[model samples]
Target: GTRGPLAGIRNLGATCYINSLVQSLFMTPEFRAHILQWRFEPQQRHAMNLAYQLQMLFKRMAHPSRGFVDAKAFVDSFGMGTAAYRQQHDVQELNRQLLDVVQTFIDKAGTEQVLKRLYEGQFYDYKRCKRCGSVTATPSPYQDLSVAIQEISNLPQALKAFTTPDEIDGVSCDTCNDKTTVEKGLTYRTFPQVLTIQLRRIDYNRTTFERERVRQDVHLPLDVDVSELIEKSVVGSPNASDDQDENRFELQTVIAHSGTAYFGHYYAFTRVKRVERDAAVEAKRLEEGEDATEATVGGEWIKFNDERVTVATPEEVEEYIDPASWKRRHVVHATKKKAAEKTKRDAEKKKEADNNDSNNVNDGGDAPKDATEPVTDVATTTTEGAANATPSGNAGMGTPVATDEAFAFGADLFDNTGAGGGGDSDAVAEKSVSGSSYYAIYRRVDLPLPSATIDTASLDVPEYVLEATKTEDDELSRDAAELASLRSVVSVGLVYRGKKHWVSCKPETTLHELTSTARQVFGIEDTLHLRLRAFSATMSVLGATYPADFTMADTGATPGSSFTLLGVEATTDAAIAKDVWPTQSITEWDRLMPIRVYQPEKETFAYLRDLV
Candidate 1:
């Protein structure tokens, strides 16, 4: 049976299952490794404590649902339940034990030695600051080196058999040592350290493997012509070998140690060049005024050029190429071609016109009678009358004929509408017979006149007129007045989603009631959500310190009211009391007083504020 408060809860079966799950979740290899790396470290202790607290809080709040409860019950009823719990408990205990062991190993190994081995045999080319004139210790002691090597090698096996390879690189100097100082006079020394190991296979590079395979399969024939082979290689011929005569390889390795610790072990291989002189020449040129230039030989170096090499002046170079002169010559040649084409076209047009004139002269000479026909007096009078008329045959000669009206009538006539065929015959006849009419004869003839029909339906009004009418009937106008009144009552602006919200309420209204009214009137259902979030924030703050009273009110003049924000004050008090005292004090009145006070205050403020 469990001891203390959990004594009666013992043998409940559910408790054991919960404990096992918690242990399994928290005592995994990854979690252990993380704890080992950071826990107890002065810099990381606060963060670790926060994480642990949050985890415990989350677990306490989580209520196992129906499925999880059912599963737990079934498992607990089985005979294997006890064995599983034992296994998880044993693992948890073992992990805790290993943590102490790891710490001991780290203490014995020494951090300085471990850091040095991490960069062993690597080309670090350490340089000392000229001002400080500090040089790193050469060849750290053998005892420290062996301890570091032993610790690192044993770590892989010690970490609960988690086989995933990991590499970490760390650098620490005198400055870092000063920064990582511990309590007391002892200082935490720092040195550069790096560790490299594969963690997990997240993805694979198939393309890289295929390319490597292709590269290995390539071969070249020894008997082939040298120049032909070169050309074939440059042009990417299928028969050309990728592993040609020029190929070479380079490899590098390094081992290092620090005070009682292994720093690192590293190895690498890369392609090397056979023509050492070529590299020398490039290096020399780089040092001199000459820019590094590629050899004329066709290969990777074909496109390379020496940008630093000075040659001819800009003017001299331009003279040599003569691009401007060439452009001018090209323009002159194009202009001459265009001129020739234009002259040919003009000559063709003139010839065609001369031929047409000669044909007209011959035809007229052959038919002299047709050309000499005279006009009769009636025809002359008719022509003169038509010219003087309004063209609509209307005798009302005062009626004006606008150009647009005349054109429209012409268009209608072409479209076969009779409106343009002739003006009103009766009116024209009446004007023609009138003895005093100056345009009597002209009125008798057909003419065009403006159409009298008006299209009143086609007129359009501007959009601003409709908008203005809508503005006159808007509900927002009333809401704005109410908001103004609410603002006068509240001192602080009401906020929703980080923006100030205008309200309409009387002064002395509580924030809680105002929020409720705002929700109903403004359809702001999210007000409750906001309150809950604020309550959470208040609780968090109260977890550290308890305040005297918690009241919420809209500072806006509209619908002014105060609502005693409930639960927050009590919740805050509870959290602070719990954290500070290690246990809660029991008093029925103590628990209920805060709630009772808050509820009445909320109701009173809400009621009085709404009256406004």
Candidate 2:
């Protein structure tokens, strides 16, 4: 069992980015224990203190009776204004700001450098001048790595690319006194107990003058080793050990985005530990009448989606890694669908035959319970659910209803479709789960716990948290009836001039209505005629213009499907410009062959060349 029931964070508007980061941080065992044990001084204990607010939030999250907790207090203390809360910001930015604020507060409170001890690491930026052979090594500190992942296949590959040496264009060498290229790269000087990596999935396209997303799915593993990436000079030195076993890390949590570069939803997958100690060791300690803390290295996985927290299989977690994996999960397999239909028909026929046989037999007690599949086991439950729910017509916009495995949190807690579809035909809206991974957190393997146990007395929830909880409960009671209407409204992106703006509407909204809404979002006047073209998530060939009166439901246009609205006048201008000065290349033959070519308005190509 977990130390406490898992809890989710309420989204304060477009605050999914913050919620995802907070969930991952809360799951970090070392970080959680340290924050809980920090004894705040009289002066440091205040509502404005970020560390105190975060500690209180964590304490509420660990409450046994709560399904979720409100983070508005903490968010307010974090200083993200109400306007910022309504707009989506990058998760990495929040991660850095939160850590920095906590570090600042910890310093003021005169506590140990908890953030530095767990999340900070040192690296060297070295430049070797080829001419002078002089090397300059600059040591720098970092709490996390922001790495470019374009064209990279995995975590290690991305790290390697980040550290790859690049030549400099010009420099005055200190020894050689010449401007020449120099090889520069990075190497790890020390590894932190917890490592946070931010995958930069968005890139700027110079030609388009807009930010575009790299939809490549990079493979992530349960464990990662950075020993090989350490500086060669430090490996055998007294500063570092030759055998760097401590450099290994295990996946603790992941924060993934699920939309385009302009807008998206954020969610997290976290590894939850049930027991933190070896069973034999714990048993022996208990037998000796010593207090033994429940701890373990192995753990189950869970997903935190806004206010919904549920158990997630290791396989299901992979779906959030990248666009390819997410798209693969939504593909409609015709063969499998047909086979499932056939199986259902056969089962019905068998049931009819069994009923006929029962009518002839005199012995009728009850159906054997042994024939039914066991529901107690997790794997068994998942298999049974999958068998009953096969891919159906709603595969385009909704997930297979039968595949939602029930757990303590309830199966209906999450809207399976990213577009807010609740497994109903009327609400069958397509969801775009295909997006690049945004953030990941890793814990050092075999990291030793603090020598002194955390003081349980210091882990009390603050009064502010209690008051906030009551307010949240009241709000929830009032908003319960409005959730259905909220789910029916889905957001789709409208692209113009290489930029995407999202517009919200129901699935039954017509193309004309959608266009009108999109135009308003873009602040376009009614006089400008707009040309609409649709494209798949993968940027497939642009589909033909849709009829203005056709509803989104009729064409199965789901959330994240891009509809480009091109102004008729702007498009015509581009076409005319292209035709006026179409790029032409001059053709000439060698002097020895001296040839000139000319053509009359109606002359054939062969005749024109001969005449020239």
Find the candidate with the highest TM-score and give its number: 2
Task: Tell me how far the alpha carbon of residue 419 in candidate 2 is from the true structure, in angstroms, after superposition.
Answer: 36
State TM-scores per candidate. Answer: 0.12, 0.53
lDDT of 2 by residue, 1-612 (tens): 223246688988998988888888777767777666666676877767888888878876765445688898888886767865889988888888888887776645566787898888888877888776777787788889988887887888887787788888697777678888888878777778898998888899999999988776786655788887776652232344355557788777778888888988998877655334376874454344342232322345677888888876533565554334333333323334445666896699799999989885646655447857543565565556555554566443533333444343344455442345544222222335544467888778786422112233455445554555667555654575466555566566676665667666777888777667667777776656654544333442232234456566655555434343322112333333223112221122211122222222442222212432
Give the lowest summed-lDDT range of ten residues in model 1: 436-445
lDDT of 1: 0.27
* Model 2 lDDT, residue 203, Cα: 93
Q: Go through the candidates in order and give each one's C-alpha lDDT.
A: 0.27, 0.64
TM for candidate 2 is: 0.53
lDDT of 1 by residue, 1-612 (tens): 011110011223223323322222221222222322332333532322433222222222122110111223323432344563443222223323333333343424534333223222111123222233333322221111110111222222211233122322232346345222121111111111221112111123486542110101111110111122122211133333344321111111011111111111111110111112264663354344242221201011100001111122222211112223222333444455556666886699689999998897787554446657763455445445545667555644633434434344445444332665663222211111000000000000011111111121221212332243244324444665666565455433333333344444445555456445545544563423323112112322211111222233322222344422222222334344223112243233333232211223233222212222
RMSD of each: 41.2, 32.4
Model 2 / residue 96 / CA error / Å: 1.1
